[model samples]
Target: MSAPLLAIEDLSVTVRTDEGHAQIIDRADLVLRPGSIHGVVGESGCGKSTLIKAVLGLLPRRSTIDRGRILFEGQNLLTLPRESMTREVRGRAIGFIPQDPFQALNPVFRVGDQMMELLRWHGLPGESPPSRGRIDRTTRARHRAHLISMLGAVQLADAEEALERYPHQFSGGQRQRLLIAAALACGPKVILADEPTTALDVTTQLQILKLLRDLAETFGLSMVFVTHDFGVVAQLCDTVTVMYAGQTVESGPVASVLGTALHPYARMLLACHPDRAADLAGIPGAVPSPLAPPSGCRFHPRCPEARDACAAARPATREPAAHHSVACVLHDEPATATATR
Candidate 1:
C-alpha cells in the first residue's frame, strides 16, 4: 500500500510526578493510511489517549518524549519546532475532536466566535482578514456563511441559529456535531477523535458514528479513532490496534485481529464485547499503574496464556497470519504451529 499518512515509531512518553518519572506510553507504534479509519482500543489508562496526544503534540507540560519519532506526511513531528508545530501541524494538518465537548468549547463565547477564531488561525477557505483587529461587516457575513456551510456538513440543524447560541444550549450530540464542524472547518487531512461518542445516548452515538464514517469517505479524511467499544471498531475502522499497559499487544485488519486475535489480552478484550451470544466477561485485573508497570510483558500478570518466558522478557511482535501481528509469546513459535488459546 501507500506510505502511511501518519506513523508513530517506537514512541515512549514519560510524565513527572511527585514520586518520579512515569512512563505513560511505551514503545507504541501505529500507522494511519489515507482515507481510512484506524481504531485504537484499550481499557482506560492504557495510554490510548496519551498515544494520540503525543501525535497531536498536545502532551501535558510535565510530559517528555523519552524516545521515538512521530512522522506526519514525511516530516518528524517530534523534531518540529514549537512555533512551526503550532502554526502548521496542530489544526491545519491534524484536527482533534475532544471527548468532552463542553470542555472543548468556551462556555462564555458564542459557538460561532470559537469556530471563526479557528478558521482565521488556520486560514481555511472563506477566511477574511480583520482590519486593525476589527472584523468588517462583509468579512463577518462571509465567515457566518462559511460557518453555516460547515455546520450543515456535519448535519447540524438550524445552522445559522446554532452558531449564535452557547455550547450549553445544545444537546450533547449537537455539541459533538459542532465540535466536528469546527474540526472540519480547517479541512484537516487527519482527525483524531478521542471517545467522541462516549457521552452520548445510544441513538445519538450511532448518528455520530455514521456522521464520522460519512465525513471520512466524503472528504478522504484519515481518522485515528480512540474508543473502548469493539462495536464501534467493527463498524468504523479498517484496521485495529489493541493497546495494553502502554504497549501495542495486537494490530491488524479489524476482521483478522478481532476474529482470530493471537494475543491473550486481545482475546480477553474481545470476549468482553457483548455482541456475541456468549456471556460477557471482563478482563480479570485492572490496568497496571504506569508509574510501575509490570516487568517484561505488562500484561503477564493478567494474561491467561502467559508462560514463564513472558515474565522473563518482553515478547517481540510476531506475525502469525497475513496482515496480523501480535506481541505475545504464544506467537513466537513457528507459523506452522498453532498457538495455545
Candidate 2:
C-alpha cells in the first residue's frame, strides 16, 4: 500500500578534526513507518543524536555526510537544496526535540513567537510575513489563537498566562512540554526526539513519555527517538536500532531484541542497565573512542562473545526471520521485514 515514511540506506557521517576526518555514523541503516515509534538506542558517543541531525542537515560545519540515501516521504533529502530543506522538513514534515529543553528555546522570544515562526515558515495562511518590516493586527491575533490551541494540546493549562512568560519561567517539565507542543504544532509526519526525557525527574519522565505516546497516536506521527536507556525504549518504541561506535549492531521488535539479544554489545548494554540487572554488576569499561574506534566489530574488545572472527572482520547484519535482524555473527539467517515472524 503506502511506502515507508522514512528510509535510511548505508548512511555515514564524518567530522573533520585537527588530525583528520573520522566517520561517526558507520553505514547505519533503518526505516520508520508512518505513526510508528522507531528507536535508536546506544551508549554515549554512539552518534545517535548525530544521525537525526544528519537527516535535518543540521550537522556541524566540520561534519560531512560521506554516503547514504535518506528518503523522506519518497523524496531524497540530502539532494534537496538547503533553503527548501529548512522550509519543508525542519518543522513542516518533521520536528526535532533536542535533549535539553532549556537550551532549545530562546530566552529572548516569548513561547508564542517560536510557534508563530514555525507556522510562518511552513507558510500557514494568515501568519505569513509580508516583508521584514510589515504585518497587521489580523496576523497577530491569528498567531495568538494558534499558539493557545497548541498550548492546550500539550496538556499545559493556563494557555494565555503561559504565553506571556519567557522560556526560563517554566519548569523543566513544562519547558519540555512546550518544545513538544511546538514540534507537533506544525503537524509533522516525523518527530526526531533526542532524549526528550533525560533532563526531567523520574516521575516527570514517565508522564512525558505517556504524553508523547498519546500525541504520536492522535497525530499519527512517526517518531525516531534516541536514548541510551532501554527502559525508555521499551515503553515508547515498537522497533529498535542498537548502535555501537556509530554502527547498527542489532534491530528488531522491542520485545524480541530486549528478550533475546543476539549481538554481544546489545546483550552487554542491556545487562548494564540497573533496571535489567539481576546479579550482574553491569558491563565494565566505557564505549570506545569515536576518533580511534576498535577494529572489525568495534565492540570486539568489550564483547564477551568476541571471537577471532569478530575481530577479523565487520559482522554482517543477519535476518533470521521476518521483522527481526541482528548484526552479530551469532545469527546466521538474514532478517527481513517478513522474516521476524
Candidate 3:
C-alpha cells in the first residue's frame, strides 16, 4: 500500500488547568490515506478537536504537544517554523472547515474580498503582487472569476452575486458552502472538517455531507471528518477511529468496526444508536475528566465486560482481523469469555 497522506503517531497533548497540566490527547494514532475520508468519532471533550488543532498547529497558548509527531506527506508538521507553517502548510497544503461558519468569516468585509485576499496572501497561481504597482483590470476580473467558479463547484446559487454580499446575508447552509469554497480555493491535499454539519438541520446536514464527499473525490483530497455521530461516519467515512477520554480504543475499516465492534465502548456506542436500539438510549456514565482520567483502561469503568485485569494495566491493541484493531483485554486470552451485561 502507498504511504499514508497524513500520519499522527503516538501524539499527546497537554493543557494548563487551574490544578495543573492535564493531558487531553494521549498517544493517539491516526493514518489518513489519500483520496479517502477518515472519521474521528468521540464524545465531546474526547480530544477530537484537540487532535485536529494539533495537526494544524492551532493549539491554544496553554496547550503543548508533549510527545510524538504529526507528519503530512512525510514532513513533520510539529517541527516546522511558525512562519513556514502559516505560509506553506495551512490552506496551501491543508484546508480547514471549522464547525461554526459564522465565526469562520469576518463580518466586516465582503466575502469576495476576503477570498481574494487569502488567494493573494497564499500566492496562488495567477495572483499578482500589489507591491509590483497597480494590478491590471484583467487580473482583478480573473480573480473574481476564479472565486465564482469555486463557489459554483460548491453548488452555491448566483455565485457571482453571493460574492458581493456579507456572510450574514446567506442562510446557515449557504454560509457553510461558502466556507467550503474558501477551503478549496488553494486546492489543498487534505481537508480537516470539524463537525461542519453539526449546526444544520438533518436535511441540510445530509446535503453538506454529500457535498463534502463529492468534493473530496473530485479534488483527490484526504479528509479527517471529526464528529460525534456514528450515522455520519457510516454514511461518509471509509475508515473510523473511535476515541474515548484521550485514547483511541478502536480503529479499522468502517464496515469491520461498525458491523462487529470489538471494544466494549465501541459496542456500547453502536448499541446506543437509535436505529440499532429498540429504545433510544445513551451510554451510561459521563466521560472521565481529562485532568484525572481513570487509570489503566480508560473505558473500564463503564465497560460492561470489564474484568479485574482491565484496571491492572492498559490493554495493548490486538488485531483479530486484517486492518482491524481493538484496545481491550478481552482479546488477550482465549479462555476469557465475552460478556456485555
> What CA RMSD would you report for each candidate?
2.6, 4.3, 2.5
Model 2 agreement with the true structure over 255-305: per-residue lDDT tens digits: 998988878788888987888888656666778777787777888787776
- Give stretches of model 1 more than 4 Å off: 125-139, 334-341
Query: Which of the two, 1 or 2, has more TM-score?
Result: 1
Candidate 1 structure lDDT = 0.87
By TM-score, the better pick of 2 and 3 is 3
- Candidate 2, residue 141: the lDDT equals 77
Measured by lDDT, the strongest candidate is 3
Per model, state how many residue pairs clash: 0, 10, 0
Q: Which ten-residue region of model 3 has the weakest summed lDDT?
A: 125-134
Q: How displaced is residue 289 in candidate 2, in Å? A: 1.6
Ranking by lDDT: 3, 1, 2
Encode model 1's per-residue lDDT on 1-341: one tens digit a residue.
87899999999999999988889999998989998899999999999999989988889999999899999999999989997787678987899999987688899999988898876666654343343345657766776788899999999989999988998899899999999998888778999999999889999999999999999998889999999988899999999999998999999999998788888888888788889528979788799988899888899999776677777778899888987888887778655234333
Model 2 scores a C-alpha lDDT of: 0.83
For candidate 3, give the lDDT of residue 309. 72
Measured against the true structure, the TM-scores of the candidates, in listed sequence, are: 0.94, 0.92, 0.94
Of 1 and 2, the candidate ahead on lDDT is 1
lDDT of 3: 0.88
TM-score of 1: 0.94
